[model samples]
Target: MNNYKEKQLEKSAEHYAKKVFKVIAAIVFGAIVFGLAIYVLMRLWNWLTPELWGWSTLTYWQALGLFVLAKIIFGFGGEGACKPKKGKKNKKKWKMKCDMRNDFSDWKLYDEFWTVEGEAAFKRYIENHKKRHHENEQKQS
Candidate 1:
């Protein structure tokens, strides 16, 4: 019984140590990547600006500050962004709207709408439509 408990304790300790090591390694890697990006940005800014715009080159921290500032200014859309909601009712509503918009898609059946047969059909449809409108107007009158 004591040996079993000792083995379980060792296993738990090892599991926790591995978890902690992974978290620490991820943090260190993220920091290194972020610092390298900032250095590269500063170098590019220094290489480009002075030649093209007569602007002074930026240092590492200044470039990092500019990046953060840009993110603060333009990165977040707050609430104005249209995001797709996963609700069934919203999906149904959006689908219904799309279906309504596409109700006339069947009218695009002809490659050339002014084809000879299509023109005759068009005239028949228009005459029928006008007759219905005339009847409606006469009834109203």
Candidate 2:
């Protein structure tokens, strides 16, 4: 009975190990394919934009700089092209407060000017307004 249990445990362990290996293999394969696609795209872009690629206009170092800049601007990997190092402060601080109109018609002017915190504030304001309105209706009834 002990021998059977040990064999079953070993089989289970081997099955889990195979799963882990498969996952790692898939991740590596995905990375390689993604890298190849990026390389192909960059090559095509360079070929098409001859003015942006010439040695006189952009040396090796300049080309690298431009590539880095483009990556920063476009956010190639979705979240950001490059992650900031630990302990490094982000230099760009968005202005939180702006001249926001109190009237509902002018709400559109402030639509793009809000931070996440500001959005929460606005939502809370709306909720409070609705609650007050409901309370007033209850009092009237």
User: Best candidate per lDDT, number?
Assistant: 1
The C-alpha stretches of model 2 lying farther than 4 A from their native spots are 51-72, 75-141
TM-score of 2: 0.38
Report the C-alpha displacement of residue 17, candidate 1, in angstroms.
Answer: 0.2
Candidate 2 lDDT by residue in tens digits, 14-81: 99999999999999999798566566656666666676655233344455566678789976674332
Off by over 4 Å in 1: 76-141
Tens digits of per-residue lDDT, candidate 1, 17-62, equal 9999999999999999989989998999999999999999997889
Model 1: clashing residue pairs? none
| Clashes within 3 Å, all models in order | 0, 0
C-alpha lDDT score of every prediction, in listed order: 0.85, 0.68
